[model samples]
Target: MAVHSLLLGVVQGATEFLPVSSSGHLALAQWLLGFDEAPLPFDLVLHMATMGATVLYFWRDIVDLVLEWLGGFVSARGRWSEGWRYGWAVAAGTVVTAFPALGLKPLVERMIHLPWAVGLALVLTASLLFAAGRLPRRGGQVVLSSGFFVGLAQGLAVIPGLSRSGATIVTGLATGLKSEEAFRFSFLLSVPAICGATFLELRSVGSWGDFTAALPSGWLVGAMAAFATGYFSLVLLRRVVTLGRWRGFSLYCLLLGLGTLALSVVRG
Candidate 1:
């Protein structure tokens, strides 16, 4: 169980920020490993670990945004600062993302255990990434319009095999934002989305007593692994995006999607 937990943690952390879908990988990994579905508490814990990693990695940007907003309010200059504007853009994107997410929640949940469905979604994700890579690079800030579209992409990515980070970042890039800016906005937007998901999962817990009763030591070890790997993955992905290596990931996703589809058919 400890080994299983650690393996899943690594999967969640490594793939969560990549163009590949973490949930899809997790579902397939569980199926292939013959492991039972993870409990809500354990899943939540793993998510929280990754969330913490995000916060820690982007703490400076977060602090700058908060301080800039406060400065805008306190200063004689009534105009909003650049950071505040970007912050609002992130908020707007999050709001837009919620719409489709709310509607797709049931559908996504239903497909979570369906390997074939995940495989299909991975193919779609690959197409999106491939197209995004072909788009000419443009330099621009993340405006409300770009944010809305990116948000829509993010919401659509709730499907099991579609990666939220991949979808949103690619959408941002496609909309003319620079790679680094797009990556930054994509992750900043995720902070709220992840928090909301964690809250919803926690709220659904029937009993704290029962939930904690079966807590395993492996859970903590898994979470720690997630945090460590998540941080490194973020760093690696940032470099990959900056270096125009997104197409490499697109090819990987394409191959993986095809392999998964083939495996599903053979098993069936």
Candidate 2:
């Protein structure tokens, strides 16, 4: 069980930020390992770890945006600040994301048990990544409309094999945002989605005691492993996006998606 947790943690972290789908990888990993879905508590912990990694990676931006946004209430100049606009963009994105996400909950849950569907979704992700690489820089700012469209992409990515980061980043690029800005905004937008999901998981967990009973190590292994790898993956992905090196990830997703589909057929 510990070994399984460790391996899944590694997969979760490694794929989470890499334009590859973490949910896809984790679901496929669990299926291949012949395990039921991970315990609810540990799932929460792993997600929180991802959230922590994202927060740590972009702490400065987050802090500055937050402070600047907050200052807007007291000063007109602050209200027109970049941070204030960026902050509203984030909020707008989150709100738009919630609609499709909630509406598609049933389908997303069904994707969990359907590896072939997940594989197809990964192919979609690869297409998005490949296109993101070729898009011209629109040099657009992260305004409400751009953010809203990106959020729609994020919402659709709730499907198992679809990469949330891939979807949002590509959508941002398609909307003419700079590559670096797309990358940064995508992750920042994820913060709220992650928090909302984590909150729901916590509410569903019932008791903390159930978590301890399931883990001899008290969920520390998954959390630590995920956080460590997730942080570095963020660092690596930032470089990859800024350098226009997205083709490699696009190819990887394509191959993985095809392979997963092939394996499912054989297993049947």
TM-score of each: 0.94, 0.95
Off by over 4 Å in 2: 216-218
Q: Clashes in model 1: which pairs? A: none
Clashes of each: 0, 0
Highest lDDT, which number? 2
Model 2, span 1-268: residue lDDT tens: 6777777677778888888998898888778877667777777778888889999999999999989999998899999887888888999999999989999999988888889999999999889889887888667788888779998988888888999888898898888898889999999999998898788767766677875666535368778888999999999999988887889988988998899899999998
Q: After superposition, how far is residue 96 of candidate 1 from its true place, in Å?
A: 1.3
lDDT of each: 0.85, 0.86
Candidate 2 lDDT score at position 193: 87
lDDT of 1 by residue, 1-268 (tens): 7987898789889998888999888877777777677888888888999999999999999998767766766785623576767767777888988999999989988888788888888998889888876878889886778768888898898898898888988888988999999999898888998998889888887688967765565898889999999999999999988877778888888887888889989999
Positional deviation of residue 47's Cα in model 2 after best superposition, in angstroms: 0.6
Indicate the worst ten consecutive residues by lDDT in candidate 1.
76-85
